[model samples]
Target: EPEVTQTPSHQVTQMGQEVILRCVPISNHLYFYWYRQILGQKVEFLVSFYNNEISEKSEIFDDQFSVERPDGSNFTLKIRSTKLEDSAMYFCAGKNGQRSTDTQYFGPGTRLTVL
Candidate 1:
């Protein structure tokens, strides 16, 4: 089965830096989303993109964050400036549509660590 893949399963960065988390979503999937789990906290939705534009976004998606489908198969999330609070496991997810209650398949996640 096709699956979402993320790079650099683990990353260590300073408190004020830039990071680009990469993801390759399922080939045939159309809906893409980004979610983050801060250690033991609940998984919070960051943003959702479809048809080359944002479909839905949560408040957590602040000015420092951005996302794009750089090409047919690659989806990326860029953080302009990192903060201590930004350290979390970022998960990339993709879904076909809402036909089946919008089930999202998540990647193993890229664990971001800030010091």
Candidate 2:
């Protein structure tokens, strides 16, 4: 079974700076997504991509945040400007359409610390 993976397990950025988080979803998966968990908060859905387009996205994924697949193997989330409140553990996930069972695999997560 293939698994999702995120780069730079941990990232530290300054407020008002730009940051890009990268993820590689399961090669066979049809849907790719991103989620974030703020300290002491529940995991929140950020965005989902399918067929090279955005399938869905939450309010948290505002104009400041963008998602793209620059290449066939990489899905990326970019924050144009960082904020202190943006500090969180970002997790990348992928789900394949399995008639028997729908399973979403997650990456270890990239911890973003903004100061």
Q: Pick the candidate with the highest TM-score.
A: 1
Write candidate 2's Cα lDDT for 52-104 as tens digits.
99989998999999999888889999999999999999999888883447888
Q: How displaced is residue 48 in candidate 2, in Å?
A: 0.7
- Cα shift from native, residue 24, model 1 (Å): 0.5
How many pairs collide in each candidate, listed in order? 0, 0
What is the Cα-based lDDT of residue 27 in candidate 1?
Answer: 87
Lowest summed lDDT across 10 adjacent residues in model 1 is found at 95-104
- Model 1 C-alpha lDDT per residue in residues 85-108, reported as the tens digit of each score: 999999999998956697899999
Model 1 residue pairs with clashes: none
